[model samples]
Target: MGRYRETYERWKASPEAFWAEAAREIDWSKPWDRVLTLEGDLSRWFEGATCNTCWNALDRHVEGGRGEQLALIHDSAMTGKVKRFTYRELRDKVATFAGVLQRHGIGKGDRVILYMPMVPQAVVAMLACARLGAIHSVVFGGFAAKELATRIDDARPKLIVSASCGLEPGRAIAYKPLLDQAIELSEHKPEACIIVQRAELEAPLVPGRDFDWKDEMEKARAAGAAPACVPVAATDPLYVLYTSGTTGKPKGVVRDNGGHMVALKWSMKNVYGVDPGDVFWAASDVGWVVGHSYIVYGPLLHGCTTILFEGKPVGTPDAGTYWRVIADHGVKALFTAPTAFRAIKKEDPAAELVKKYDLSKFELLFLAGERGDPDTIQWAERALGVPVIDHWWQTESGWPMVANPMGLERLPVKYGSPTVAMPGYEIQVVDEAAKPVPANTTGAIVVKLPLPPGCLPTLWHNDEGFRNSYLADYPGYYKTADAGYLDEDGYLYVMSRTDDIINVAGHRLSTGGMEEVLAGHPDVAECAVIGVADALKGQVPVGFLVVNKGVNRPAEEIAKEAVALVRDKIGPVAAFKTALVVQRLPKTRSGKILRGTMRKIADGEAWSMPATIDDPVILEEIGEALSDAGYGRKG
Candidate 1:
């Protein structure tokens, strides 16, 4: 704790100097002339520095005699296969892939789209793009053709990398057809598409435009040609990842090279308490920012073995798989989404699988991607005998903005709080007027400019959109759009997204807070709380709950227990009386609850279906439940 406060104060006093010192840990091609330069909202970090992200992540480690050391441990429960790659092996593959891309005239500064699953080839493809100094725009593999087409039009990529199929728990879903459809629908088409024959589905190649991945790799290897790492400027674009927007369009978040390298390396050591050669696992897809920073770049940059897991928490042969993997690999740290634990808790409440494995090797477990509820945190920490940190960040901020800073010092655990801001990040709770609020008072969360390294510099192709969406919301601060508060101890409690906050009888209430309470109910498996229009109170919370399997209690009785628990825990201000038991809550393919879509259904507003949704039928079921409960809109 003392170390945390000390580092925070030191960073606040001299951020540029602090970051400069941290940057020294990595192998830079050329030293920076200026540590930082700022003009209004725009920032330039490590000015005059030139380096290749691939060189830092791979070549440096291999050149430093760690070539035989394990760099990637790919475990695919979906395919029931495991593969390992050493630093040297991964480098050779990336070099060959880069050569393949170069043969097609794709070079530095060109954009390439990666639409693939959580496979080793996806990792190879991303590293290959970085090796050539090309910017990779990774669209989530589960995205539909229309959504993929939208991103294709925006990026206009020169090349596309995809897989023939993505294996789910019970079925193998073909992806090459989807990619073909997306290419057909988009106005801009790539020069060529490279497809990995994963499931052996017959995917016809369009002459002169489609190429088989294995054939190209073999040819490149036979030719004895390997692409050299192309040096890129510090401020050059490394990747552009899009975020889901309510306006039916996505905002491409751009991350620069140098700052991203430095910040992520620092975070891997200081925030996650991981060192070189350790096994670190972040159970996220390659498309997300967490995957970009931790699973791929950060750990590799720090010379650690990163795991690429392709499995769910409960489905891939029960809840014991994670424990088995940790035990088998001696994984030092595990980072995953809180929703995963919630689902695991529902499937195996006692966590019997935890005792089956020798998890003594695990040092820490991290939770993110959604709000970490108290029940989920306590369950994981107590079961795993490790610190379960509830860190907070978003797509725009590549690394965590608020975390426990485990490498610095382990502090007293606050169940729901994500703890203090990391070095270079100054967070504050402010009211609608953009003025600072008192401690323990909920308000919009904002970070004082300029943001730390690893944060998005701007939205791709839309500078004004970046300013209007994030910067202009509150002058002088980067509006987080999420609502939270700081305690007297400086621990931050992120309650909900500002739009998800409910106003009941003129008092603001956090639906996430209410959902946390509902989660503690004995008969509840999972639940989502959403604010629906109330003619009198402006808005009120309506809960959609999934009752725990094998619970003997009636659905109505379980709902009553949930309401009582919330009423007692949150007091009368919560106004959380109504709840309905549903079979399943609408969720994205990544398992995020679709609260916004639920709110639209409750309010009877015109809604566009999100391509990321797992099941469209769940929305209809919710509507039926709402109508039966008399909260449905009049048709």
Candidate 2:
């Protein structure tokens, strides 16, 4: 703890010097004229610098005589395939693809969208764009054509790279057909499309706009075409990643070149505690931010081996898939979402399969992408016998804002909190008027002016949207839109979204807090809480729960126990009265609970269905359950 305080003091004293020193670790083409500059709400680091992100990720290591080092390890349980690529091989492939893109008239500042699966080609596409200074936007592979059409119309890419099909546990999803339909539906179409034929899935090819990906690469290699790295300005755009908006249309978060490179490289050693040649695995898809930072750029920049696993946590083979991967690859650091653990715990509560593997090499496990409830955290810690660190960040911030720094000093684990803010982030809890509140008070989370290096600079083509969404409410702070409080020791306890707070009889209550207590019940597998309209109180807490399978317990009995557990843990002020057993809770594909949607459905209000919903049928089930409970008026 003292070590944490010491590091914080050094950073708070002189942040510009602190970050400038961190930037020295990267390989720069030319030095910057200024270390840091701020204008109103925007920040620029390493102004006037020229650097190529692809060169730092690939060429630098190969030039340093570490070309033989392993750079990528891809293993897919669905296809039973294993592939490895060294730094030298990766650089050559990137150069070849860069040449191919150039031949199609895609040059610097041109937009190219990549809609491929979790294969090695996705990484190559991203690096190829970075090599030529082009901007690449990758959409998740499983999205429908209507969803893909909106992105195509927004980005207006000159070219698109996609695969023929994607393989899941029990089926093969056709991607080329999806792309075709999306192109037909979109108003703005790309000039050409490149397709990787994986399983002979036939797709209609337009007369002069579609080509085979492998054939183009072969032709480029045969002609001895190799594209050199193009130097980009420090403030140039690196990539635009759209958020998985559960309630609205997605926003493109734009990340810059030099700052993103420097911040990710520094965080690899300082936050994750891994170095060159270490094995790091983040169990997420390439479409997400974690995959962008950890799986692709961060590990490669550090010359480490990153595992890209194409399998689900529970179904790929069995409940032991994650354990098997860790043992097989000797993974040193593992990162995933807490919802995964909840699923595994539901299937195997006693952890019988986990005991079968040898996990001596596993060092740490990280949980992100949602709030980590205390019950889930304790279960993971006890089951794996390792520290489960819950870090917090957003898509806007490329990397972690608050984490327990394993490299600096490991702090004592707090069951329900993401530890202190990382260096270079000034976090504060404030009321509605933008005034600071005392410790142990719940309020909106805000970050002071001059956000650190890796944070988003602005929205793509929508600078006004960026200002109104993040900076308008707080004069000099970036509003996180999350409701949380800071403890006496400076630990952060993220309660829920601000709208998720329930105003019960003029007292505020966090549904996250109530859900955590309900999850402690012996027979409860999963639970979701929402604030429903009540005549007596302004709002009241209602819980929807899923009991463990094969538990041989009555639904009514389990609900009574859950209510009793909440009453015993949290006092009467919580206003937690009712618990209804349900089949499942509605969630997005990324595994976030749809509490707002649930609340609307329970209150009999019309709501727009979110685009990212995992299963729409679950919404009907929830509505029926609510109707059976006598809250059935539909408006």
- Report clash pairs, candidate 1: none
Local accuracy of candidate 2 as per-residue lDDT tens digits, 1-635: 77777887888998878888888878888889887778767888889998999999999999999899889989898887889999999999999999999999988899999998899999999999999999999898867888888888878899999988887778888998889999999999899998878863555666698998898999999988779899998888989998876223458899889999888988888788888999999998888898899899999988888999888888888878899889988888998998888888887888788998899989899899889988888888889998898999888999989899887889887878889899878999999999999999999999998898989998888888889999999899999989989999889989898889899999998998998898888777789999999999999899999877678888899888888888888888887778999988898877889998889888888887776777899988988888888774533
lDDT of 1 by residue, 209-243 (tens): 88999999999888886988999999899999988
221, model 2: CA deviation in Å?
1.0
After aligning candidate 1 to the native by TM-score, how far in Å is the CA of 395 from where it should be?
Answer: 0.9
Per candidate, the number of residue pairs that clash is 0, 0
Please give the lDDT score for candidate 1.
0.89
TM-score of each: 0.98, 0.97
Best by TM-score: 1
lDDT of 2: 0.88
